[model samples]
Target: MAACAYCGTTILFGGIKDDDLRFCNDECFENGYALVIARSVSDNVVKREANKIYNGACPKCQGIGPVDVHVSHRVYSVLLYSSWSSIPNICCRSCGLKSQASNALFSLFCGWWGFPYGLIMTPIQIVRNIFGMARPPEEFAPSEKLENLVRIDLATQYIEEKSMPPPVNDV
Candidate 1:
């Protein structure tokens, strides 16, 4: 008899699926084993579809643009210059707009990079960068208000970028 992987309940070995593996019982098999695998697969599909929707839309107009837009990832060196960062941006063949692929990614980067209020600093940094100011130092502290500001800026940028007309020349 094999023990349940999760609860360790003793059970007779049940037959396998295609992989020839054994399980303790139907409950343990379904809840402990199969559900985990299935959840991963479902998550992957959802992520792919979200990416498809994000990349397929026109970066400038947010409308469905030309079908030939290419999605690519690029690595950039941040302030430390030793560690490299990977950023996903989209290049449009129709509108010629090149910008970050997803707002969620921008949010994640801020959250992950030790910025307490990254959601706010990110767009401020972007706007400051656009206006020729040095981005706030990475170690700069952020507040809850800053986080809200960053989220608002990101939303506005998204809306503006999506509503603008596509480029005239077909790239």
Candidate 2:
């Protein structure tokens, strides 16, 4: 059993191959190729610049930072329909805490009305929110996810550039 080089899914059937790399599908091939090119363009300089930008003032409160990313879950249910989502924020500690508190309350109030999933997910979401609130934000460093977000943003731009055709030398 071989695994796809791009998404790591086990290949149960014939898949596309590029030299030594195998992909599960065309979408994975395209995405993986773009990632390779993006990695080539995203050198240490790009990472450092991204780090500096990420450590700037928090987007929500404009407070002095090295902000961290906070994630909170919310669940809503009515009868047979239940939906849940995770809300993520990059902000200072105070802002993150505030958001978490509000989201926790929202989940507590509106998350237990559905048939089965609401009953199951409500407590889970509340517990997750509680755990998230317990983790204190870093004062002098960006969260790991924050750094990854910055890197991804830069990588996307680089991928776009690599995919574009070269300018024609029109004299």
Candidate 3:
């Protein structure tokens, strides 16, 4: 059995092959190609596409120039419970800053209730947010980080949309 190149699913029968890469289905082929294309494109093309996406409507506030930013926090309960999670905010810098502030505050208050891990992770999360806020994204251009994020996002969306089953109409 051959493993699929993109998703690593087992291939029990004949599968797709492009050169040495094999895929389980057409959807996988398309998804894999999407990622390959994103990675193989020149930096100039990538930057242009990234800037176009950044100029589009922001997913959160429907504004413009939204850059991808990740904000996470930690929460601890009593003695034995602790959790670390991120609040996903892919929006403008202002919105991301607000999200970072609130999540950091939440971590500061709630993340110190557990055991040793709570004490350790709380400060780390807070410091991370502080440093992240210190470096705001470019106002008129997308950074290299933002361009890579856009590429991944585009490939992910392509995979998601292609992998969904077609709707069946019941007459």
Candidate 4:
């Protein structure tokens, strides 16, 4: 009933010889170990610059800044209500690539367990994030300095994506 740790193939206690570790063969062990290394690298690279990516000014362009849109679904969690689950990560209004990627990772991996409301809301929110990042590139102005620093050529239109919508003062 035991499965190989690397390939998930059935293995007997006598077949693999790693004591407590369950590897069917040497090849599978090597491959599974390689995957572990790759995942570690991805985690390190993404997490190392997390502060700047989530807090600092836009790395791609000069004008656009991050925002805290009320539409973010992360505001709710199963254990806590209202502001308990609200982790305010930076969101881009002009070009939302990095922010969307980060938020999508969080929603899909970390908060997908948000049931009831999240069951319906989580998918819709991810779609919205995708659309936010899919806006036309021409709508923004590209920055060469950012390209040199981050190696990503992102562009933007405005400093702030959300204006108070002309303040429905008359209404």
Winner by lDDT: 2
User: Which sections of candidate 1 miss by over 4 Å?
Assistant: 1-56, 66-80, 90-171
Clashes of each: 2, 0, 0, 1
lDDT of 1: 0.37
Q: Candidate 1 has what TM-score?
A: 0.21
Q: Candidate 4 clash total?
A: 1
Off by over 4 Å in 3: 1-38, 41-45, 64-78, 86-88, 161-171
Q: Write the per-residue lDDT of candidate 2 for residues 45-122, one digit (tens) a residue.
A: 445655675677888888876677788899999777899998878777778788888888998989999879889998
Cα-based lDDT at residue 126, candidate 1:
44
Candidate numbers, best TM-score first, in rank order: 2, 3, 4, 1
Per-residue CA lDDT of candidate 1, range 31-111, in tens?
A: 445333333233333333334534466655676633222322222223423222333223233332233333324433533
Model 3 clash count equals: 0
Quote each prediction's TM-score: 0.21, 0.68, 0.61, 0.32
TM-score (C-alpha) between model 4 and the true structure = 0.32
Better of 1 and 3 by lDDT: 3
lDDT for 99 in candidate 3 is 81
Best TM-score goes to which candidate?
A: 2
lDDT of 4 by residue, 89-134 (tens): 2334554566565676566655545556556656766676666556
Per-residue C-alpha lDDT of model 3 across residues 15-36, encoded as one tens digit per residue: 8999988999998988777777
